[model samples]
Target: MVNITVPQNSPSSSSHYKSSPEGLPSPSPPATIKPSGSGLVKDYWIRSTTCTASSTADPKRKRQLKVDIPVVSYGHSGWLTSSSLTTVVEDPWKEVEVDGDGFSVYCKKGARDVMEDRFKSFVDFNGQHKQAFFGVFDGHGGSKAAEFAAENLYKNILTEVEKMGEVNIIKAIKQGYMNTDSQFLDLNNRGGSCCLTAIIRDRNLVVSNAGDCRAVVSNGGTAMPLTSDHRPSRQDEKQRIESLGGYVDYSRGVPRVLGLLAVSRGIGDQSLKQWITAEPESNFFKIVPEFEFLIMASDGLWDKVSNQEAIDLARSFCVGNDKLQPALACKKLVELSVSRGSVDDASVMIVQLGQFC
Candidate 1:
């Protein structure tokens, strides 16, 4: 364990970081806002200072779907797993139930590859929020970044949410991403990880993405993309990079920041922090009755499968006595991608929205 303790911060904690004039833009309330205090949301308490208020903020694969963006080419000489003299532990691919009843999850580490992916799904997590919290972190270079993110991202987001007392989902989620990136940078961790998280509360489905890992929702069997993959080749992404005086290099079919990291936004990669950002693009929508299911996975699955195809396979499993076994459907998705030659760690979390009361 990397001793995942919450780093203490004071409102005037200059020692924590040398201030930047652009010192992380203050987080803005999510695009859509609903007045707080609905019967569905339970009030939660948070210490006033657990998280300092400062800024707000806040892929894949395969084939050539309508989106022509290239999948990451696996060449990471520029990045290292960990600089410490310790051997990184490898986790095997096995389906485990992290949460149940309201949701089902299935996750596996890639074969022969130190599992760089981590996931979480909790209904009424930590006795607060009284809603489902889910996420998938895809790590490159090492599992440290992914592990760290899995351990802390939710806490940070919740802290922000608690600060707002569930007043704003978007800002809380955005600050969560920013806080995770800042905390990781304090360790000067050399690797980076992509993040995709979905917070379901008040009948609202809010999703935020910081890299290529993805979140998709099935509305009446129609596949709807919830977050945009943050890749350098996207015209807007390239513009953002160039504007920051950071350029993207395409020596490989994929674009890399400074010819190094593949994704345009992520949790760490301190070296490319200036060019790449940890801020996320989030989408918030009222979960309609048509919302049947949601699938979030690392690029390993996304690279070889299309959004609609993945949803179709999931729907196929919704038959017979196994109708509620979404975890099995998740494992099947991973198997299908590996069969198709996915070359990275595969992880998937399936949320049967209809199952939620």
Candidate 2:
């Protein structure tokens, strides 16, 4: 028997609606029997030979680009399941650790063959001091949506800000999200990304989230969650999807939309566009002395680590030190999540709020 455990609502998290349990239809599994776990050496040999022969047969096709980064075997392993075999190949382009002017970021791939998580940070955006944009995007299905958003979401937001000015920051942000979503759909890309973004301008803090990615701020040693996870299990989100002619399914361990996508809101997912919206929940705050630092991460870390637990650990690494080491702190959080059995790609960023204040 499979006992699926869902994340409990946190005190710092807010939801406008309550959930009522009900039965739902489960989708039929694929008829193909996928290879499970590490397979027989013979099977790998057969597949390799077949691929080599096929490539040789089609010599006119362009060769795939070869990456030259050295592979580190440590912490990277392949796992096997009853229905499929998963491998983890280290990506050299991914930012394992980075230290910016006032922020630090860390990322690590999980058991998946490709790391679907992406992040972006721009300090002194638009050539202005104390103005910045930070984001963590968790991609599902593929990395295209995540990559596109990481590169263009802030740009779109900046464009909107330029048109609307400071007074309409919230409206500008909402428009920015919709514009990004529409632009991505126009590209005819598949998959989707859940994202959390924080913008600092004129000493004011604006935070937004469209999926499970989260933003938490440390206020005088207390952990404050600024964004709520937009899962299908969430009452308001489930109801919203149903009202729009979408149904939430409970099969496959967790509540999912049509038993396919897990999150109810995201940037792309053109196929599920009708059911999934890119509307992000946003909040505003005035930077104050009480606010110490901010933490933004994908659901990968949140799935295994609690907001308070992460904040407590970060405080030990970032606060009261002769020199700040937020990059190391971010790494530690990702490591902690992995140790706690998180198999999802984790990306974490820590921003020192006091610097902006």
Candidate 3:
């Protein structure tokens, strides 16, 4: 194996990308850094820098390759913290939560030096008092893909609905995912993101997911999953990849696409576009009294907490004649996930269905 040195940046360094007058931040540094390794080393750090190859085996003889590290500055409150209405410094080891009317969101960074998870919550969407949207994006490789999706996905859906007039809500959502993926690809960005989104319009609830992020609703305290994770371990996904000339390797104790990414479908990931997809699995349900609340979260929680256990705990804090602190429920869940040895970023949002139903 070729040894490579990665330049590390402090967390506070993200502040260097402050927003410009156009509401977009300055571009990231060009990828003209020194070349350090062999062919494999060139591919490992493709996200932030480019590498050049030499026919000789000498590292000193390799020519340096230059590229641009795609900058995702729009709609970012910071590198780690995200809130639709307000900004808060995010701390993985401490409570970082946001409370809104009938909804609350909590996000905690993982063991990684940088948090890659981003979320969105929009209420009174497009002048419609009853319309709302919520989403959670779990990013891997880099945060650019997740931040891009969180900023543009729902807006794309809204644009489609305005043109199509909601003739088919599901169709609009699908288009949104497609547009977001295509646009991010044009940026030539590395990495990808798993997304879970919930859209509430009138008395209808539409849920969609492209990766491991999940959505669960409580029907009278019963947990009902809305999306199935897209992993290579699934028989159908494995078959699909094999049919497309790709293979899943389980040698690392997790099924990965070509022994790389564990997720089979996500936004961005241009290198693995042939094997993975951005197409989301979507479902619809009519809001009813039986539906008590909805939970949208990243795999950080699911890796350690069972669905029923999460539901039961959330119910204790929220389900009653007089609801307790829904925000507290969100905090408790994230705390539990971290306490259970989850070193991944945990983000959870609790939406009380009674307000919409």
Q: Regarding TM-score, does 2 or 3 come out ahead?
A: 2
Residue 128 shift from truth in candidate 1, angstroms: 5.0
Residue-level lDDT tens digits of model 1 in 1-357: 011111111011101112222223232221211112321112222111010111122125432222111111111122212111111111222233323444555555454224566776555554534467778888766656776887688889988987976768788889999999999989866577899988877677788889888777777887787877777767788999999998977533556666666678888877678977889887887888888888888777877788888889987775334435676788788889878766566778787776553
Structural similarity to truth (TM-score) of each candidate: 0.72, 0.76, 0.75
Error of 1 at 286 (Å): 0.8
Can you tell me which runs of candidate 3 are displaced by over 4 Å?
1-95, 321-323
lDDT of 3 by residue, 164-205 (tens): 778687888888899999999999776778888998878889
After TM-score superposition, the amount by which residue 229's alpha carbon in candidate 3 deviates from its true location, in angstroms, is: 0.7
- For model 1, give the 10-residue run with minimal summed lDDT: 46-55
Top candidate by lDDT: 2
lDDT (10s digit) by residue, model 2, range 234-338:
898999999998998865456778766778888988878998899888889887887889999988788778888889999987888997778789989999988
The candidate scoring highest on TM-score is 2
Q: What's the lDDT of the predicted structure labeled candidate 3?
A: 0.68
Off by over 4 Å in 1: 1-99, 126-130, 319-322
How close is each model in CA RMSD to the real structure?
Answer: 17.4, 13.1, 15.1
Which scores greater on lDDT, model 1 or model 3? 3
